[model samples]
Target chain A: MRNELDQQLASAASEAQAAAQTLDGSAVAPSRNEPDTAHPSASVSPQAPAEERPRHRCVELGRAVVITSGKGGVGKTTVTANLGTALADAGKRVVVVDADVGLRNLDVVMGLENRIRKHSLDVIEGHASLDEALVRDRVRKMLALLPAAQNRDKDEIAPEAMRALVAELQERFDFVLIDCPAGIEQGFRNAVAGAQEAIIVTTPEVSAVRDADRVAGLLSGAIAPKLILNRIRPQLVKRGSMLNVDDVLDILRLELIGVVPDDKDVIVATNRGAPVVDIAGSETGAAFRRIAARMLGEALPIPALSDRSPWFARMFASLPFGKRSSTRGS
Target chain B: MMDANVFVVTSGKGGVGKTTTTANIGAALAKLGKQVVLVDADIGLRNLDLVLGLEKRIVYDVVDVIEGRCQPRQALIKDKRIAGLYLLPAAQTKEKESVSESQMEHMTHALAGQFDAVLIDCPAGIEHGFRNAIAGASQAVVVTMPEVAAIRDADRILGMLGSRRARVLINRIRPEMVKSGDMLSVDDVREILGREILGIVPDDEEIIDATNRGQPVVLDGARRLGAVYSTIGRRLLGEDIPYVELPNDGLWLQLRKMMAGLR
Candidate 1:
C-alpha cells in the first residue's frame, strides 16, 4: 500500500510538472515528498527556493485578520473558505466575511447557504444588524459565515462601512476573511477597505497572476499582499504548457503562502456544498488542513502540490518521448 | 455592427473551438440560403479544410488565388449540403508570412461582393497570420471556453477587437462546470470580456465526431450546441435570432438530463 501510494504520489507530481512546464517554461524536479513548496513557480529553480516556510498564520491568536483576494473566480472565495476552515480547525475563532454584495457564494461553498436568511447585505442596508447575518458552519464549531445579499449589485455597499463591519467582526473572531469580487473597480476596493493584512489568490496562468501582480503593485506602498497560488496544475508545468506556481510568485513578487493543486474532488465536494477540508483524507483537503495548521503558528511545512496523489502522473514523467522535439523547454 | 456580408470567427487563444466555430457557423449560414465563404487564414497549420473534411476536393488554396496561380472559382471548394456556402482553403505548405498584407487585403476585398458574408478563420496568435485574417473582415466573432487561460487570452483579444470595432462570440461552455464554479459560463466570460456575446456552444460530443468526419455539425441537429451555432450565424446576419442564456443553474438542464439520463 505504501509503495502504491508512493507511485501514485509520483504520478500526481509529473502531471503537475507538465502543467507547470506549460506556464513556468522549466522542468521542476519533483521533491521526494512533494516538496511542500507553496508555489511551484516560487520554488525559484530546482536549486533556489522561495521562502523557507509560511510566516506565522496567527498574528495575535485573538485578533481576527481576514485575508482576501479582490478578484472573483481567481481563488478569493477558495482562500477565504479554506483559511477560515483552517483557522477554526486550529482552535481559532475564524469568521469568513463573504462581502460579495449581490452574489452570495460563500455560504453556498461552505455548505451554509441553505441556512442563510439574513446576510451581510441586509445588515449593511439597515434591514438587519451585522450580528444577525453571521451563520455558523454546522461542521466547524468555531467557524462562522456572514452571507452577502443576493438582490443587490456591488454599487450598493460602501468601503468604509464594510471596513467598520469587519472591525466589529474582528472583536469577536480570531480571523475574518472577506471574499472579494473580480475587477479592480468598486467591488475590489470595497472588500479591501477593512483588512489588516491581505492574501491574494491567483492561479499559475499569466492573466490571473497579472491581475494579482497589479493588485500587488497597488499593495506595494500599503500592506504587502501575501500570495496564495490556488488551482495550480503541476503536470502542465513539467511539459512547458501552463505557468508554474513559481512564475506567478516571481511576477507578483509577493511572499509565498500556500499552493493548492487542481483537484477534481474540489468540485465534487463544492457541488455537494461542502468545503474540501471536510473530506479529511483527500490530498487537496489535507493540503487545506495543513494550510490551517501553518496559519495557527504550527510548524508544518507547506507541501508542494507534487506530493498529493503522486499516482496521477508517474507514467507521463517517465515518458522519454518528449525530450527530442518541441524546442520549448530549453 | 458590420454589414451582412462579413463574419469573422476568432478566439483569443488557439484550439479553443474557433475553427470548429467557423465550420458550424458557416455551415449554419449556408443552410439559411445566404452566400457564405469560410476562409482558412492559419497559413502554416491549415486545418480548417481538414476540420471541415473538405481537404480532398481542393485543387487550389488561398495562396493560389492570392498569388495569381488560379482564378478564385477554381480555388473555391463548394460544400454539397449548403448550396451557397463555399470555402477558401489556406496553403498548408507555406507559413503565415507567405501571404502579404496587401494580398490578404485584395483577397477579402474581391470576395466582399461575391458572397453575402465572408467568414474568415483567423489564425491563433498575436502575429501576422492574425492581421491577415482580420484584414478584410467587417464583423468579428470571438470564440472562447470558460476556463481561466482561455478567458485571459480572450480579454486581451477583446481589447484588440474593441480597438478594431468588432463583436465577440463565446463557444464550448459546460453548464455543470459553471454551476459548480469550476468554469465560467457565458455570463462570466461576457462580463469579464465586456463585449457583446454572440452565442454560447455547450460542450457536446457530436461536434467532435463532426470535426472528425469534417462535416458541419449544424446539419446534424442531433446536438443542441450545433443548433446554437446556426442560431448564432443568423444573429451575425442581423436576423434577431433569440437564444436564452443557458443559466449556470436552470430547469432545462434538469429536464435535458432526465431525458438523456447522462452520467
Candidate 2:
C-alpha cells in the first residue's frame, strides 16, 4: 500500500513538471525576437504583443477562486453562476466548478444541468477526462461547468484530489470559479483547497453577516477573500432598519467587491435556469457586471444604495406630518 | 417527582436564534411553575448563560461535570430572578470535541431526574456539537426564519433528527411582509419543512434588548414576543391554545385572505 501511494505521488510530480515545461516551451518561442536573457522560462516579457503573450499569464495560471458562504441559502451558488457568466461574457474562458458534491445546484443555476453526463468525481477517479466531464454552456461559448457528483458524499473527494483536479482545469481555462458547499467542515475545506482567492456572499441580515464573518476568519490565512453583500434592501438601509453595505464591511472587514440589491429579477432568472447577468434591465445583473469589472482591476465606483429613498419620502420624513406617516413605513 | 422532559433546540444554520429560543422557552416553562434547566451545548461559544443573566455566577460548566471535576448539581447555576429556573453552562475555553456523545447522555439523564424540563441549546451546523446536544433529548425544536436558506437548513436538520419527535418553530417572522407576499408565509414554511408547528415568533426589536440586558423576553410578560413564548411553553406542557393573531391586519391582509379563499 505504501509503495503504491509513493508511485502515485512520483507520477503526479512528474506530470506537473512536464505540463509546466510544455507551457514554457510554447511561451518561450514567442519571445525569440528578444535576447536569450537570464531566466528565459521564468519571466514572460510584458512587451510581447497582446495576442502573442501567454493567455495563462493574463490572469495567472491555476488561479482558483472559491465562492463560499458559511450559512445556507445566502445565494453563494447564484453569485457563482452570475460571476462566471459575466466573466465569460467579458470574453475570458471560464469554467465554474461545483464543489457542493452531494447537494449540487451550480449546474441548475447556470442552465447546464441537462448537459452533465459525467462529473468531477468521475474525473478524479480517472473514469472520464476533464473535457468529458465539463459541460459547456449552451448560449455562452466561453463558459463551462464541471458539475459535482449528485449521489456521492462530500468525503469521496479529498482536498488534495480537488487541488489536482483544479490544477488540471487551470491549465485549460483562464478562470476557475468553485461554488463551495455551505458549512465549515470537510466540504468547505475541499472547496478552498485549490483556490487562490475567495468571494464570500452574504445578505444584510445579522445571521448572514455573522456567518460571513466566521467564513472570512477561516479563509483569512490561506486565501485572499473579498466580500459580496448580496440581497441588500436599500429602503431598509435608508430607514436604519437593516445593516447597510458600510456596516457589513465594517464587521467583516474584508474588501468589498460587489453589492447586489434585493432584486426580484434574480429569482425569475434562476427559475428559468439562466444567470441573472443574462437578463437585461436587472439591477442585480448590473451589480454583477460591476463586480466582474472590479475583478478585472477596473476602478468602478461602488454604487451608493443608502440614499435610494425617493426625494418625496425623504422630505416628508423631515416634516412633522411626514414623520408621523413615515413611522408606518417601517 | 416526574421524569424530566428533555428538549434539544437546534437549527442546522447558525444565527437563527437557537440559543435565544432555548433561553426564552426554559424561562417560560419555569415561570409556569415547572422546574427547568437550560443546558448550553455550544462548548466554545457559550451564550446561553449570558442570555439568561447568569454569566457572572458561573463556577463550573457542563465540561467540568462530565470530566468529574465537579458534581452535576454543583455545575447547575440558579437563576437570580426566576425561582425555579437553572442553567448548566457550556465551557468557553473547551472545544466541541472535548465532550463525547455518551458523556452528554449521562449528564442530561442525571439532570432529567432533578428538573421538570431540560432544554439543551444545540450549536449551529449538523456536526459533532449537534450530535452531543441531542444525545439524551427525546424531542427537538428546530427553529428557523422565513428566508430560503434558513428553511433549507431546517429541512436538512429535520432529516437528521428523523423519528426524534421534532417540531418546527418559525422565528423572526414579519406578518406585514407575509401579507404583502414579500416574505414567506407560515403555510409556506410548513409546506417546505413538513413538520408540526410549535410556535411563530414575530420579528421584535425588544428581543435584542432583552438579550443585551441579560433578561429573557418571557419574563416581561407584556411584550408581543414575550406572550408568544409563554403560550408556547404552556402548549409544550399539553395546553391547546391557538397562536396569537398579529396586529395591523389592514387591506393588504384582507386582499391576501380573499386571494387565499379563491385559491
Candidate 3:
C-alpha cells in the first residue's frame, strides 16, 4: 500500500512542481515578511517592505548555483564554501544557503555557527527578517549565509518558499549558491528550490561517480550541472590506485568546474573555521578562486585535479628536455 | 534498563510502517525478557508513543534529553506493562534543526552502551534525520513496502547505507497483491534493494486498529500478526525465521480502482 502510495505521491509531487514552472519571487512568494500569526512555522518575524522582498536589482541578479553530489562525503560543502568565498572575495556580493536541514554542518564548516543564532527557518516562519537571518562572512562586501534549520524536516519547507527565497536573495546578492544535501530527498528539493544551475561535486570512486550520474539525470530537465572532482589523490592516480579525472568526467558527462586536488589543508582549514579559500596561497585556495572566476564566465581553464608531475608526467616532461641535451652531447 | 545489544528499526521511505514496525518490534523484544528502548528519531513527528498507546504518558521527548532540558532518565518514558520496554520519545516541540549530527552520534553511542536494542523510527527523508538515526547503530532494519516508488527509494537508500555500511530489512507486504502481480514481490523488492531482509510483515489490519487504540498489534497474542512481529524480533536476536507465504488476493482492487477512475 505504501509502495503504491509513495509512487503516486512522488510522481504527483514532481509533476505538480514541474507544471508550476519556476515559482517567481514577486508573483508566487508572498513577501513572507507579512505579519503571519497562525502557523509557528509560518511567520513570526517583523514584516519587510515590498522593496525588501527581492533584495538586489543589478542586470544579472538572477544567477542560481546549486552545489550537489552523486555520492556522500565528496566535499560538496567544501566546494560550496570555498567557491562561494572566492566569488565574494572578488567583490561580488554572495550568499551561501545550506539546504541540508536537520543535519546542518555547514555553519561549523563555514565557521559561522556562532553567527547562526538566526537561520533560514526563522526567515521562512517570519520569526526573523531575511537580513536578520543572513550570517555574514568577512570576505568583504561579499558573502552571507542562510543556515538550514537544525530542528525541522526540510520537506515541511515548501519548494515554493525555496523559489521565493532564491529570487529574493538574487535581488540582493550578486551570486546565490545553494549547498545541496546528500541524497535526493526533501533536502535536495529545498536545496535546489530556486537555483537554475548546479555544480556537482564528486570524487574518483565508482560509488561517488554513480551517485553523480543519478544527480545529473535529475538535473537534466533543468540546467546541466558542472563537475568539481574533490579529494583527488595524485599519488594514487599515478599508481593507478584510483580513477583519474577524465575517467570520472567520461561517466558524468557534465561540464567540468575547477578540480580541487586532495589536500590536508582542506581539513586543516575546516578545523580552523575557515574554508580552504580563506587560506591564501594554498593550492586549493587558488583552484577555488579560478572556479569562482569560471562561474562568472571567465575564459580560464583551471587544470584538472592532477599532479602529473608524478613519475609518468615528470618523466614525460623530462624526455623532451633531456633528449635535446643528449642529442647535443651525442 | 539499557543493555549492550541493540539494533535500530529503520526504512528508506517514509510511511512504510517504520513507526509501526518499531513499536511492535520493541514491544516484542521486551516481551521476550530483553530490555528495550524505542527511540523515535522522527523527532518532530514523534508518534512511536502514540502507536504504542503510550502518548498520554510521555512527559519529555528526545530533544529534552539531548538539549539538557531534562535528564536522560527523566526523558525516558518507561512502560511497566512490558517490564523492560521504555521509550525515549521525540520532542514534538523541538524542530529537527536544533539536533546536531554530532549530538545524535553522542546520544546513540551512549544508548548502545546501555540498551539491548535501540529501535529508531527513522524519518521519511534521507537528510540529517536518517543519518542521525543510523549513528552508533550496530545494525539496521530497512523496512519497505511492495511498491515501485518505495522500492526505488529503498534501493537508493540501500546504496546510501552501503556507503555508510548498514543492514536493511524489508517490511509490509500484502501477499495477495504481490501474488496477483499488483505489487512487487518479496523477490522483486529484495533484488532491487539488494540488502538482507529481516522480516516480511504481512498486511495486518490489526495494526491499524491497534494503532487507533494506541496499542501494538503484537500485544494481541491470538493473531498471526503477533507471530510475524515476534518472528522479526527473534530474527533480530539472530534466529533464522523462515519467510512465510502471503496468499495471492487476485487483482480485484486494482481493477476496481481503474474502473472507478474511468467512470
Best by DockQ: 2
Please provide, for model 2 over B39-138, each residue's C-alpha lDDT reduced to its tens digit, 9 standing for 90 to 100. Answer: 9987765768767767768899999999999998899998878889999998866777898998898888888988889999997666567789988988
Task: Give a tens-digit lDDT track for model 1, residues B1-263.
Answer: 23346666776455567778888888888888888888998664466776676776778999989989999989999888768878999875566677877788788878887988899888654446766777766678877776554565566666665445566665655566666567655666667877776766666545544654456777776655665777788878787755644433564464245223211
Q: For chain B alone, what TM-score does every candidate structure achieve against the true structure?
A: 0.89, 0.91, 0.86
Best candidate (score: lDDT): 2
Off-target runs (Cα >4 Å) in candidate 3 are A1-59, A304-330, B1-263
- Steric collisions counted per model: 58, 1, 29
Query: Share of real contacts kept by model 3?
Result: 0.03
Where's the lowest-lDDT run of ten residues in candidate 1 chain A?
A319-328
Docking class of 1: incorrect
Residues A54-162, candidate 3: write the lDDT tens digits.
Answer: 2222333547899987344568777888877766554445678888765566677788887787888888878887777777764333467789886677777888988
Model 3 DockQ class: incorrect
lDDT of 3 at B108: 71
What would the per-residue lDDT of candidate 1 be over residues A85-156, giving only the tens digit for each residue?
Answer: 765554445678876664456776777867887977687778876556677677665577888776556667
Interface Cα RMSD, each model: 13.9, 8.5, 21.0
True contacts kept of each: 0.01, 0.04, 0.03
Q: Could you tell me the lDDT of residue A22 within candidate 2?
A: 38
Model 3 TM: 0.48
Docking class of 2: incorrect
